[model samples]
Target chain A: MSWVVENLDLIGRLTVEHLRQSALPIVLGLLLSIPAGWFAFRFRLTRGVVLTAVGLLYTIPSLALFALLPPLLGISFLSEVNLIVALTIYAVAIMTRFVADALSSVEPSVRQAADAVGYGTWRRFWQVDLPLAGPVVLAGLRVTAVSTISLCTVGILIGIDNLGYLFTNGYQRQIIPEILAGVVAVVVIALLVDWLLVLAGRALMPWTRKGA
Target chain B: MDLFADAIAWIFSPEAQSGSLPLSEAIWTHLAFTFVSVLIAAAVAVPAGWLVGHTGRGREAAVALSGAARAVPSFGLVLLLVLVFGVTHKVGASTTAFVLLAIPPILAGAYSGVEAVERRVVDGARAVGMTSRQVLGKVEIPLGLPLLIGGLRSATLQVVATVTLAGYVGSWGLGFYIVQGIQIRDFAQILGAALVIVVLAVVLDLLFALLERAVVPHGVAARRSAD
Candidate 1:
């Protein structure tokens, strides 16, 4: 408890860094994945190939991806760019699949209805399909949020600062209180972000609240 | 060419491939961690899922919890456990984190599986005066088996990734090779070890795919695609 108080400022800064690492990738992933997912949907031949590649990418351990990215991308191993780039790739990998799944889940009748109303392709997508895809896409975004936050902490192992640093620092010094604080701090950040996403999801899709 | 040659050389090296703690040992250790934690998680998660699905209780909370569980950084959790307990039970302590990671997916899969079972089937069983146990065993279990196993598939993937992370806590696994390679700047070992993890995860998912098929009853298997 005392440790948490003394190091409160450091923990706060780390959490903010963690949020930046997570938030930027999720935003980037959302932007890229929408188009990528639509391309996969529109081009059936590419669907199997694209999804398989994404699955393979996701299967590679986060640690390995971090270790490999610097060499592959010709960046400094210790640079923050390596961590962000690897995490962004991860964000893209899962979000693309989620986008595909969300779009696929939209019923054929909904598409037919849009056509019946004389909705054009792009306009129909934004007005009809995109809105309908909200619940699922939001769910995926929530997952992306949670995962990126967790993965951010992994950077500490490779030498970046985040709440994960608390664990490493505490472990090195055998300070149980600081280690406990790190665990609590990380979980609190995770839950806090999760609730915020939930609120955003509900606000965007007021339809979901109809039942409630 | 060096990476290729080094990879090839490392793959065929007898010492690296066979020892008390060789590549095979590392793979085995990784599998052991994944399997043990998953087995324990299933025991805990499946029952909780069953109760929730059966009674329509706590479903919302379960979903929330699973999301929270996913958000807990496996890497940090393992390190904290080791810090608190030292390395006396590295495998056991690491398993705690893996178990936490495994439970949520399995729970969700199972709950959804049970929840997905057409209510009429359950209603019919109840109308016939069957015990709740009978309905669950004869109807729910068979029908929900696919998703329950699907949960296991999700859990297995998580555990595989997590067991690799667990290596940082002195738990022996394929991750040790990756960690050692990272420490020594041995790219070949890192590549080889990373390859093992990827292959293992893919193979396990494929195996679960088959198991998902075989575990369903013939009647449900026919309707599987329809569902």
Candidate 2:
């Protein structure tokens, strides 16, 4: 407790940095996954290949991916972009499957109804399919957000400097409070973001609200 | 190109093969850690999950617990445990952390797998004069095997990846190279170590996928394909 109090300023800065690193990849991943997921869902021929490939991306360990990315992408070893990019790849890998599954979860009868009412492919997807898939996609996003926040701590190994620093630094200096602070701060950020996402989901998709 | 070239050379170098902690030894240690942790986690989680699933009790709590567990950073957990237990117990501490990390997925898999079995099937087993234990062992367990295996698959992947961090605590594993490389600013060593870990993870994942497939009952496989 004293260790955390004494390092409050450092903790605050690291928490903010941790949020920054995690948020970018999550947003980028959502943006990319929607299109990629749609393509995989809509196109029967490419579905298996695309999903499998993306799924394989997730099997690569985080530390390994963090280490390999800079060289693969021609970035500097310590560049923050490498971490962001690696995290985004992970986000995309995870969310794309969820997105595809969510879209598939939409009833065939609903699509037929949309088509009969003269909704074009683009309009049907935007107005009907997207809305219907929102709940499941949100669920996936929540998982991604929590995992990403937790994973961002790994960036400390490369000297990217985030709450994860507390773990390494605390271990080196034998400051248990510092390590506990990192863990609590990370879990708080994840839960807060998750709660916000739930609120946003309700706000954006009122039809999904309970008893609506 | 030079970085990759250096990494490739380092991977094949005699020093990497004959060092104080040889590459092969690191691989074995990583596997042993992963195996033991996951086995311990499964032993604890599986029955608890089965109890929850079979009796339809404590499920929400179990799920909520697992969800909370997911948000814990594996890195922080390992380091905290090591510090708490002292450096001499680093292996026990990290293994405990790994077991904790592995439990949620296995528990989720176990209960969900059992729950996925049709109510009618269990009822039918009961109608035939089978005992509760018999129904669970024969009906629920067999049907739930695939999902339990799936849970084990994910748990294995998580543990394997995490065991790499044990290197940070001065433990043996491929992560030692990454830790050592980072300290020395040896990009080649880091990359080479990363490549090996990636290969190990992917290969293990594939094996699990195959195992998951093989464990599925023929009737269940046929019914799934029919769907």
Which of the numbered candidates is closest to the native, going by highest lDDT? 2
Q: List candidate 1 segments past 4 Å from native.
A: A40-44, A68-72, A75-78, A202-212, B1-4, B18-20, B224-227
Residues A1-212 of candidate 1 have per-residue lDDT tens digits of 88888988988898788887778887888898898888777788889888877776877777767756765677866667878887888888888888898888888899999999899999999998888888888878878877888888888767788888888888778888887887777788877887898998888889878883
In order, the first chain's TM-score in every candidate is 0.94, 0.97
**What DockQ score does model 2 reach against the true complex?**
0.82
DockQ of 1: 0.56
TM-score of chain B of each: 0.92, 0.95
Per DockQ, the best of the predicted structures is 2
lDDT of 1: 0.81
lDDT of 2 by residue, A44-162 (tens): 97798888888788998888898888877788777799889998999999899999999999999999999999999999989999999999999999989999998899888888999
lDDT of 2: 0.91
Tell me the lDDT of model 1 at B136: 82
